[model samples]
Target chain A: MPTKAMFLMIKQMLQRPFTNPFPVKHAPKDVTSLVEKIQKGEVKIHPPVPVPEGFRGKLHYDPERCIGCRLCITVCPANAMEWIPELRKIRHYVSRCMFCALCVDVCPGKKFPGEEKAVKALSMSDEFLIADYDKYSDNLIEEPPEAKEKGI
Target chain B: MAKTTYYIPVGPIHPALKEPIRVEAEVEGEKIVKVDVKRGFAHRGIEYMGMKRNAIQTLYLSERICGICSISHPYAFVIGSEKALGIEAPPRAQYIRTIIAELERIHSHILWLGVIAHEIGFDPLLFWTWKGREKVLDILEAITGNRINYAMYMIGGVRRDLKESHIKALRDMITYYWEFTEHMKEVFLSDPVYKARTRGVAQLSKEMALKLNVVGPTARAAGIRMDVRQDIPYDAYADMDVKAIVPQDIVGEARGDAYDITMVRLYEIEQSLDIIEFCLDNLPEGKILAIPNYVALLNKIKKTEGEAIGAHEAPRGEVIHYLKYDGTRDGPAVWKVIAPSYNNINSWAPLLLGAEVADIPVVVAYIDPCMCCNDRVAVVEDSSGRLLDYSYLHKKAVEKTRKLEKELGVRR
Candidate 1:
């Protein structure tokens, strides 16, 4: 047992630290300035720990493909999906989402006679850095994918 | 003149306690003379919340009942729900469910080992054990989307299929834990300091364990030959011969102390690894879900009228869920849960009665207690700060029901 401990000691000594430092990496006065510095290759921001494939993080919605079946609403344990009867769509409150991914499971992705759509309308993206000052911020909302083209 | 005795209240809040529970102990010269354990500080009304939702939603909600054994509540809930609805998960699905549950058990047991070590002020051991535990958690995340609150278990089957990559990860993890547990035995079982702190601490007897009705590993530590998997088998467990792990079988006599508990948990980790390996080798190929359609599943639950009890051997102990469907609502008409900590808590007062003051944390941590899992019902206190007894609360409940009926112009 002590031999194992010795091996672990040497191994950890050579390995990079497993945990983040107290303040974390690369804090600056402004995010815009930090982005500029990174773009110019003057600074290198360290990457965080690698998440596994198919990680459940923030909610991502494909409104164009959405059929509005409301099955996601029925199975969402957190009540994070709000039904808009007039719009016939669901509005998500990311602050209330527990990231359980149950809504994504119940999503009725587009299907033709022979082939199924590759992706569901609602899915879990890898973007987990979703902390924001506004709980109802525009960034947190699942804006329509066509908003840029149609200027909605 | 020397004082005869001193009264000390260890909780609702204390340094040693990780959760909210009150234990009042009277001590005379470091020897506890009497003890009283007062719980009901951590109830969240999760069962009540579950009953208000549809069956599938309630299934995921039950997974949040305990933070450590996240899979245990949902296992029991799905088992009970499937029984009430008369739906059987595919054979492959049953094996997959067993795999995930065993993975959770390995992780939970390691977590408890770290917690108990930290309680005893062995910080290095805590760090090392948790570091080793990260392997299992990583595999769990790879297989089930998230590390905790997996949201992976459906009513009749599991949500995700175990891919080839996932099985490879699990097999590697099983090997890692097999070696990890051996080192744990050296550190926790045979170490002189660990044994000194825990050898005679929280000692319980076989008769006392049976009388208290404790379930899970806490009862097993006292050499009780009972386990939910072994007694009332379900799913893949129905086929496997899972015998309970008792301390007396390993050691000559059953001291049923904290040291024995450490040993029991460490061995159980190997047992879980065996279960996982068995599942991986025997995993059948077929559809993973009996009723893959969520809408169809909820509709079936609405039309079903039945009641069933499901029990599972969680890392801490047995978690049992009672569900009833009245053929009216999609969710359970009534939902009741009996977490192992509720029954294991019965031994606290008796064990702490004669224990030394220093042994408080030892006794408390030995149970691997989950306050949130146990305290499903809240304690009622009146405005004047008087404790309301059971009958008074029952009368108040009835009055409220009658008041609601009158207000709504509905008569019973």
Candidate 2:
């Protein structure tokens, strides 16, 4: 056996665990009440390592700014977004989204020189915890209360 | 007296096999006489889906072909699409792509090493190697914004720019990985048990490798100097000098077994670090993306109707994407993606023959077979007069899934 690896292994044994003690550090006495505690602000949460910059996570769409151009629907690979002509907005399926952020890049919302306003309305948010059981739920789509623009 | 023969079906799903490759091995006692391989379990048919979407949309589909070599498909697809459009990605974009691709190779090789070590029952080495691999993944996540399906490649160029911060990160990453390589050498290379389990076992002759038409490290391990980066030289590889790492270069001779593959892969991880460093040092400063707007890119693809083949050197081997676009269609009229594992799968027949039943996992892992890519490739094989079609394979896969579900229920 090499002296170096042995020493290193020994050092590792003496030190704290390399892995994060996630649940072991924070598990409440009663397991089912953990959710209730979190909701009631009785339990503090430990966040994961901070996400990187430009990390494609949850979808965030601005209805007022959106032109309903259908560029996002046209470009989504996973068929995650659908153009609803009646609503004059796009319907996004968060469950189906690949988090590719192609729609974010393609959206023509950013202002250019001599341009009056930003037209491309869709963008991505850093909120990644968006998974849910129901695929067609209120959380998935961006059905804003106001800003109902007529179809151009 | 006739020798007793037993046929063992390893998987459509087995604990030993990582992917859904069914290996029907004809074993006489402990020695494998002949092995028949059947795929088509993980075929999601992204290529067929690519045809339904626009060219820009298809790039995302290409990225999902195999999670391991995720960038390779999009790299080839974009190159082919660019060739078809008669536009070139700026020098800055090419160099950035080169950086990402090399980084991808680093992670892939390290991942493969960990898997191979696990297969050989070297659990300590597996954990140790994977620990080293996490650094690469962190850098990748930092650079491209995602870990696996990077979505870094745009049609004409890369989506993200390698900023000053990214350059500093790359430099630090190179330094960290270079030191990690030294530790890896001390741990894995000097171990006699690793050498015994790997060396001389499942030795593929140079002639057999040539006959099998293997690519990537497997080909290099067999003394065949075949590398797509050296031959085709897409991205910044065309501009920079790349030295192909063969088994002989490291271990003094080509054994073309598990050990040589391991050596070739380990060496490749070092080479990738060198390439990344080179790219950062000589990186051209400009815009990251070639196409100004998304529709402008779509318009170019919409107008152009031509055929072009793009090849990328994935960590496993060569990935070729052939795109045929008819001007009228929203997407490519025909999109054919041939991943490296598709070519490398053919060598398994010769490699597995005469090997002991125990060596099956190592032999299979030697090819670093990505069945998700292979499943897309439909092979019609005729055994004597019996022909196996898509329907037959489909039925077999469905039956296996149902059986598994039933087995789960019974266990519950």
Candidate 3:
């Protein structure tokens, strides 16, 4: 085993005789100020141009553009999207959505404006805080009451 | 008649394991003759879910793989996809990623230290380690806005940025952590019982560690000289000079045992502090995200095809993510995640064999198994529907009393 006596002597010599006689330091600033500054300015809330490619925002389902394709209903992992056979449209419950964005990306119809584009159309509100479970689920659909009513 | 070997199944659901793993031990007398481990109880088919979701959605799902390793999985996936798509995150984002990753490492290593101490019946060390670990979590919460799951890393870049205030908070934390490290070193190195319990126990030879494909601290303990950060640099590791830790060479040559492994992890914590300080001092400024032209991004993503493997040195060990994209609307992710636990879990076999029954818990705890993020210990019941004797319970209580006395400044 290594000798501790020599190391202890060295450590004692190196040690400061007293703790630093400094006053208690004040709490530091929150780090999010930098992000807040960047996200603060308002640009176009939602551009009319087709949703930018590779954007994973909220999902949009246009009933008018529905081709009655059941592809999305089958692929929803959280089982959030349901096909209403009678209405020939998909009803998505915001409660179970994992926001995996499978339904919006896989939707075959280009009928009405794409849901991905519609989501991008919604302004980037600083409401990233999802307090209630319902609000998080609601994020999957663009028409959640929390979102604006500009889109038709 | 020949003596029959008794097989006892510890858990697919038991108090001892955090996740659901069933250990079937064949015992003759108190000696375990054979052992088999079975898992998959907590497997929620995350890979299949990832396939079903688009690339963007899968990011959130990947973060949920392990609560403790929340940032690493997403960071690996994002970096992998970004590499596949040929995009670079902003300089500031890179620094933020590095900071968060180190913070995660600090919390994870401290937590593991506490558990290891607990397993060895040293409750005071466990308490002190965990108490110190809280400082790391507090720093994490201040930076990422969440304690366990930071959710800061995005595909193109990061969602949050560090302000001047954040830097000040971090500086304060570093000071406290420095003080804590001095205390930890004293306890770990000077404590007679800790040395007695850990030294020469659960010995993993270098050859066996290499053969088993062990990763992380477990392999490091055995002097394997493998760390993904040092070996294959990713994120900010390439930018910074990363060094892999080994057993103390100044003291003597490597012994390749449990004590050496513990020492490696403790020393690595100091190294992580160095890396964090370097990253903070060199904080860069720029846009956090790459705003590619929508048309170009979509067209490129639509046509993108191929597979790439991204590996990160997570707190436990190397976490490898295999991603494949086949020009589908889902935008490239037939994703397969292999956590560090996968490699570390198998190593338990070699270490646990030929060890005493009392040493089993400590040896197993050393691996720092996740148990699939579920670690509730269940009450053991006998065949007659009666609770087993609580002999270990009394011992634990006495241990707790001793710990309290130490904390209260009472000499035992």
User: Which candidate number maximizes lDDT?
Assistant: 1
Cα misplacement distance, residue A56 of candidate 2 (Å)? 0.7
lDDT of 3 by residue, B338-383 (tens): 8877777887766666666777887788778876633212355668
* Top candidate when judged by DockQ against the true structure: 2
Which regions of candidate 2 are displaced past 4 Å? A1-15, A20-29, A110-120, A146-152, B379-412
What is the C-alpha DockQ of each candidate? 0.45, 0.51, 0.04
For residues B96-148, could you state the per-residue lDDT of candidate 2 as single tens digits?
99888888899888888889888888776677778778887888899888888
Under CAPRI classification, how is model 3 graded?
A: incorrect
TM-scores, all candidates, are 0.89, 0.90, 0.69
Candidate 2 vs 3: which has more TM-score: 2
Over B238-320, each residue of candidate 1 has an lDDT whose tens digit, in order, gives: 87888889888888777788988888888899888888888899899999999998888888988989999988888888888
Candidate 1's C-alpha runs over 4 A off are A1-41, A111-119, A143-152, B2-4, B381-412
Overall local distance difference test of candidate 1: 0.85
After the best TM-score superposition of candidate 3, give how far the Cα of residue B276 lies from its true spot, in angstroms.
Answer: 0.7
lDDT of 3 at B400: 99
TM-score of chain B of each: 0.92, 0.91, 0.86
Candidate RMSDs in Å, in order, are: 5.3, 5.3, 15.7
Worst 10 residues of 3 chain B by lDDT: B372-381
Sort by DockQ, top down from the best: 2, 1, 3
